[model samples]
Target: MDIRFDGKVAIVTGAARGIGYVCAEMLVESGAKVAIVDILADTLAEAVETLGKKGTVKGYQLDLTKVEDIAPTVSKIREEMGEIDVLIQVAGILAGNPAEKITVAEWDKVMNVNSRSVFFMMQAVTGQSMIPRKSGSIVNFASIAGIRGMKEPLCSAHYSASKGAVVQLTQQGAVEWAKHDIRVNAVAPGGVLTNAMKSAPPEMLKNAIEPIPLKRLSKPEDIAAGVCFLASDVAANMITGQTLIIDGGGAVVGV
Candidate 1:
């Protein structure tokens, strides 16, 4: 299907690299004027420069952890990018620690970025733009880790917990915001071959892939395709409160 977002305005967080960057690139290619938000100033600038070649694209450098600043930053995006039509919450962090070895500080760090930032960003975008217009689509980035436990070297209790919160948050937003004509959903990706994954030891990468029904890690584009579908108002209009699993059938085999 040829999906398009011509003339729409979108906000994509954590869009400097990996799956986030690919989503921003695809959105621009589809003709949406995009506001790519990230905490990495240098990388954000580079992303804007590259994506600008395709279509209208801008970058906003803001730390999502500072929840207080989200509203104002979103307001600025509105002033600059026009009324936001879609929001792709793709910014998140991951850590690996056994449940018993996890620290409070580590837990807080992951939750702040992955869970807290997601809720507040949704609130800021929905209230400032979508609710007033009574129209919008939101796609939150969740993980397979949130839905199932992992074996050693990949397990992190706090990371899983934060993603679980995201799944719930997406559902809550969908139920509460449906009356306003907004659709909220999530994309749970598993074992994507991002730069971080590519850098892992060969054995570790192999171990990660062996459990998949499709014995290969997902490309960033694979996840981006699912995200764009969920973020498309025309494509996913009737879909809400759903979590689309883009895991190469890993979930099917209990991976």
Candidate 2:
């Protein structure tokens, strides 16, 4: 089936590279005007330039961890890109440490980036754009680690805990915003070979792939397709507060 987002204004955080970049690209290709946000200004600019060649795309450099700045950033996006029609919260950080070795600072950093920022971003976007318009779609990035905690040397307790929060936040936001015509959902990916994952030690990478029924790491495009589906009104209008797992059957295999 064909999915079209003509005239939609979309904001995709962490759009500088990997999954977020692919999401933004897909939205543009599907006829949406996209504003791509990321902490890396240079990379964000490059992304915008590349995606612009395909369709309308702009870049914003912002530190998502600064939760206080989220509202203002949303304001800026609405001002520059027009009222938001869709928001994909794909900006996240990964930290791995044994529970005993994880320091307070490490835990706080992970939580702030992975969980707290996501909530506030939604608040900002909903308050300034979606809520006022009474219509929008929000797709967040969660992880398989969040659904089921991971063992040592794979995922830190902090990362897992933060993602678990994302799962709950998506549910809460969806329930609270449904009356306003806002849909909140999340995409939980397993072992995607993004730039970060490509940097993993060979042994670590091997261990990650072993449990996947597909026997291969997911590509960024795999997750991007899922995000596009959730963001599409014609495709998922009735779907909300759900975490769609795109793990190559890893979740089914008990990974």
Q: Model 1, 1-255: lDDT tens per residue?
A: 789999899999999988999999999999999999999999999999999999999999999999999999999999988999999999999899999999899999999999999999999999999999999999998899998998788899999999999999999999999999999999999999999889999998888889888899899999999999999988887999999999989998988
List the global CA lDDT of all models: 0.94, 0.91
Give me the overall lDDT of model 2: 0.91
Candidate 1 TM-score over all chains jointly: 0.98
Query: Per-residue lDDT for 191 in model 2?
Result: 83
User: Evaluated with lDDT, which candidate comes out highest?
Assistant: 1
Which has the greatest TM-score?
1
Q: Which 10-residue span in candidate 1 carries the lowest summed lDDT? A: 145-154
